[model samples]
Target: MPEIGAPHKVTHQDGGNDEISLTGLSGLAGESQTPLAHKTSHQDGGTDEISVGGLAGRQIFVPYNAKIADINEADTNKHTLNLETALSETRKIIALIAMTSRVSGSSVFWVYPNEGTTGIDLVATLRYGSTLIIKDATQRLQYSQGFANDDWDLYCFGYVVEI
Candidate 1:
């Protein structure tokens, strides 16, 4: 029998009765094993509690896209898009590609981080065939357009990183 809290040797070849503890595994660089808890500090005076192995300072990119079709001039309300479905998670937008199928001569689209934000406080201004490369941390996005009596198809493509 194995001692309590000690590493156990696997004697079964079927791999069905194996017991393993993360504390028993050797860390990278052959260091002594320890519990999988790491705290990292950020430049912005924030910290993250990481629990997994080999996941520190690594970013995973999640693809995001939204299509707003048949947007008319009367549709002046702020359209809100949630970058992540989960409310507890926040994501950073790294890049964006905004395309419009039809645009009037004076048409313009504004992208912002919050509701009730006017065009003056926009994070990005997009027109027909616009691709923007930016890094902004936000959980939700607000989109609105400026024009009248025009039908447009808006397509947005971007990638986000969960913070």
Candidate 2:
């Protein structure tokens, strides 16, 4: 029944809820001019909050202690993730990539928009457990590399434009 594009190997190990998905063709390009996803609501520490924009259609509250980034085990890609120069000074579109459990390395992570580039356009390409979320439809921003010396505990959400 399955064999058109391949990549359906749900590994349950033994428990109950184990899922797998790879629905193909994210080769990018949904057409970009960015902007088109704005919604908003307020109140945080006092509760009463909602931010359903996911890609910043207006719900762009984004303050999970401000975009954490730590990649040890000898970081590379010239070592980045110092975010919040207003989200690394423009150009962001990740959506979500929350990996915690200290995230050990298997290598391969990219989500870039800064540090003066010339080529190599990427906005997301993480590995390890993989796919907690990856929004880039061509909003683009891939810039990350290896990890081993410090382990990992990275988080990133998106939308600087393009819903």
Q: Best candidate per lDDT, number?
A: 1
lDDT per residue (tens digit) for residues 100-159 in model 1: 555453556665533434442122334443444433454455666665555666676554
Please give the clash total of every predicted structure, in order. Answer: 0, 25
Model 2: residue 55 alpha-carbon error in angstroms: 18
TM-score of 2: 0.21
Location of the lowest summed lDDT over 10 successive residues in candidate 1: 116-125
Write down the lDDT of every candidate, Cα atoms only: 0.50, 0.41
TM-score of each: 0.37, 0.21
Largest TM-score belongs to which candidate?
Answer: 1
Model 2: how far residue 96 lies from native, Å:
8.6
